[model samples]
Target chain A: MKKLINKPENFVDEMIEGIILAHPDMVRTPGEDKRIMVRADAPRKDRVGIVTGGGSGHLPLFKGYVGAGLCSAVAIGNVFSSPSSDQIFQATKAVDGGAGVLYLYGNYGGDVFNFDLAADLAELEDIETLTVLGRDDVASQPKERSADRRGVAGIIFAYKAAGAAAERGDSLKEVAAAAEDIIENTATMGIGLSPTILPTTGKASFDLPDGEMEIGIGIHGEPGIHRGALETADEVAERLMRPLVEDLGLSSGDRIAVLVNGMGATPLEELYVLYRKVHRIAEELGLTVEKRYVGEYATSLEMAGASLSLLKLDDERLALLNAPASSPFFREG
Target chain B: MKKLINKPENFVDEMIEGIILAHPDMVRTPGEDKRIMVRADAPRKDRVGIVTGGGSGHLPLFKGYVGAGLCSAVAIGNVFSSPSSDQIFQATKAVDGGAGVLYLYGNYGGDVFNFDLAADLAELEDIETLTVLGRDDVASQPKERSADRRGVAGIIFAYKAAGAAAERGDSLKEVAAAAEDIIENTATMGIGLSPTILPTTGKASFDLPDGEMEIGIGIHGEPGIHRGALETADEVAERLMRPLVEDLGLSSGDRIAVLVNGMGATPLEELYVLYRKVHRIAEELGLTVEKRYVGEYATSLEMAGASLSLLKLDDERLALLNAPASSPFFREG
Candidate 1:
């Protein structure tokens, strides 16, 4: 394998150690257990805390969002595996201000069970906790069953809006409501030209023929809606954008935030190529693109593909996105 | 070919169009020719204007630096090709405030020829222009021939320091001097596990066996110092860090800036794993890492490898790096 790693078993810890060593000003291990990282100035009294957690491999996703204006802490796991309930509880304890804590994370069975258990543990200590799942991947389920849809790159919307609410001293209930509102309005779909390779197994996450592509694939290599010959950038953009606008019931006068995310190995040049078509389509549909992000926000190891996410926005969501924030991998103003 | 592009010929223009549409607030085409992009508020009165340009593949390298407190403008070219002299001259004119303009770019033959020609054109139009080429790739030449080394990711140090000098209304000579100083202090080396595929050629950039790596590889697949079986992350980090530390004549009392840049397909997780070892090495040597940047600063489309750069830092260099700057792809505060 051509992976630039040491012993596969030490992959996650080594990465976390590097993060702590590189960005001590922004993030730190909350306690002796290095798996839980909280913002350096976490536990702000009278402020609602936001805690997120998921598997490893998705940099700038579960852990990269932990900062002053984003998630207060994160519980990390091994590649493509959920964090343990104890670790999640530890994250909750680390970031708990007197106001309470909110659990925000992707909607996967393993993560859901783990975060739910962590909430129960927090309640034993008299710390109020609320859970809001990021469910925005439209291809995972029909609109009628939207709650079952998996969360992809669109969770960043929830993180931004909810984090802003928490940062401004909002109550835990208000923060959870804000997160849920953004999750309800966001939609995302991904196309994979290649599969990611797992370091531990030293194997491909999924297999496909040399020139084929998979549409609507999940971040963990879960099966998608279609598997066929590769399509052009314009064609793929259209395929992903149409369903997102439809799922959000977007109209001509709608204002939206768009994210054209590269999976892993796809070039930034190609992401812009995809974003160009998405822009043209948004204009053609009479939708106004207020804010756009084109980069590698969420990735699946070195998988070569791209995902498109649209968040139907109003004044509140737009203001939240504009708020100044800083983290190791992201910054906003 | 699995590239998500409509036509190979349309790649550069399409990417530019996407950038313009996505970031209209921060950048704009200064004239009818969309090949040239300048910061939205260019031509700041009495401030030294900075312009940079190079081939198209390296995003954020040549163009992504144009913004407030960064490069004022950029002239773009096709993939792995230099911008025309006319385009560079146009960029120089667009950002030339009452003070003067500084041409900062990588050291490549095509770029040197074009930027020099552009300087002549700018002089004819009464626009004062100074040139500072980035030549920091240590493996391309020995210490006795350091002036001829190929420029790689280390050019970003020049861009940051020089851009800051210009932003504070320094004269053209001062800006060029800052860039030159940073270029002199910086050293970079890269490793390649595989080759990048050019969109136009539908072929690999260089040939390498499956499990072998090329150490000290140039950004454009130029010959490197060694080729052998892929080494572990720690070993690779040691191989790269030792030379950079020695080339700078670093000692126990020195402060340095560390950049671990991914050359496109490598995962961020792997980059951190590499950084862990690099940080440990710095500690062992008593060198202080006062500033650190880890991401895809410079890239060759989808090459699966990485580069490490070290800049021996003084108070002035560290302050310039700490200055607030913003561009489409980068932000510092």
Candidate 2:
């Protein structure tokens, strides 16, 4: 439970200040509302401005993704908490160009509600906007209702595709469409090895037996669909990927892009072991893994387990994925 | 001491398999060695061939830096153990183009030994070769002996600079020079809040009290220069950055790139708090932070705490850093 901080309440503010300090190249202009952060080089005119925002713990996710070829500005909230509506609106207004802006991010209750409200506020500002919510975690919901699945690391995939399209001068509608395409084809499921400590509580968000894992858990320590004894890497991969493959209706001859992502605590060595089995299974199932990524693209503090994400790829998806992209979380050719 | 591993001996192998499976776009030839990995799209003859390797566990460090605009190949060894000379030789040979190949990585004892051996072997094959080692951790040694500090996240900066230089058709010598320049100018020092769990032992790598931290540790759970009760983010920033700033010989009005890197386990919010204090202190000293990054760049499993890296930027370093680069560990325009 050891942490470096003066007080829990001051954690976010202090962290933002530190970020501004460390990279004077990047700006953290605290808006009238403190939740919004506008990059100093933002307000790129005539480009489809990209904006992403979410809770604070997932660094580089909502914030690190801000820069050229990715998000232009990001609105941040407290750890695991959603940004306020005004904060989202301020971010939107700060980055909006006459070309309009795309509101892209994970699909969460707070984010949905607040982003919707921000879109309305932007309308008042005469800034046209389109929202693309990422709900790619198939394990969060049954196949019949993947729309309800929580968003997770799979959002990094969306960011790459959407960032490339927007950077290429795609219209906001086109950018939103590209993101939705990525979301529709992607499915993710995660297990937790250790819980993240909330800054305020200084205790892990949840608890599990030392030898157990909770399958299909949310990034914020939400109760997973099932809890089971720790399993082998092969078993772990199967448990996480079975539903994804079936839910996506991936069959023989399908091409997929796989991501064996760490929840933060898991080592890359462990992720690679899982990747070994995942690749074998996919190949056996006749799926072609055209593009692959392994590492901690998205993290959940020091959670120990890993998640498996499969994106069924078409020619266009492959092209977009292979396209050059630059961001803190991911990069491409 | 909870870990998701089934067998200790199988940890590294399984992890490697998982990474290839996860990224079908990358390949590890079978029955060869655990350390060798290459882009699935091999024989990329037209482009410069980039290669790097080192011990395992420093995720996104050696392996994650493989992609367009970055290293084309990576060889991995056991956790914190350097890959064998044979393995390095194979990697150099696999990535060698008629134009030549560049060997870029950290300056760990094992890495230097093995890479030197590989260079000899590659020369026998008549393939041109150049080597660049990133030795930027400032606290590992004194200012007069800064070359002794272990390379840490600052290597990522090297990858960015060298990768961009190579991508831009720089000769192998130029790319090597760029990486070396980054290493020479970079200074880093780290603190650990906890220890990583080695899969084999199923135990923490090091020990620290619940409210204490170890400053100036290596990424492999090595002991730091001092151990003390954890302090506020502001104090933590000063503790980590003071040595790095002074080591770089930076004065007021100097522009530097700052990285508030998590060792693992440390939350982004806390990193940002560290960032705030770092910025304040740097500004007060009349230093300008031209660039900033905060996250788990080079992690030590799930150990907590963070490190600060300061690279005094001149036009040459800034231009190289600002160049477009793509790698799993870093991407920038």
lDDT for A240 in candidate 2 is 89
Error of 2 at A166 (Å): 5.2
Reference contacts recovered by each candidate, as fractions? 0.72, 0.72
DockQ of each: 0.82, 0.50
Q: A144-237 in candidate 2: lDDT tens per residue?
A: 7877878998887788788788888898889889989999989999888778877788888898878888999888887888897888878888
Candidate 2 backbone clash number: 21
Q: Tell me how far the alpha carbon of residue B101 in candidate 2 is from the true structure, in angstroms, after superposition.
A: 7.6
| B153-177: candidate 1 lDDT, tens digit per residue | 9988888998888888789899999
**Candidate 1 Cα misplacement greater than 4 A, ranges:** none
Candidate number achieving the greatest DockQ relative to the actual structure: 1
lDDT of 2 by residue, B1-333 (tens): 555565788777776666655555445553367568875554466456778888777776777778776777888888778998888788777766676888888878988998888889888999888888778877677878876767888887888788788777788888888888888888888888878877777787777778888888888877778888888777777888888777878898899988878776666667777778888889889998777777767877667778888888998888877876554456676
Instruction: Label model 2 with its docking quality class.
Output: medium
TM per candidate comes to: 0.99, 0.85
Cand. 1 TM to true fold = 0.99
* Candidate 1 residue-wise lDDT, A1-333, digit = tens: 778999999999999999999999999997899989999998899999999989999987878998877889999899989999999999999888889999999999999999999999999999999999999999999999999999899999899998899999899999999999999999999999988999998889999677788989999998999999988899999899999999999989899999999999998999999999999999999999999999999999899998999999999999988877778987898
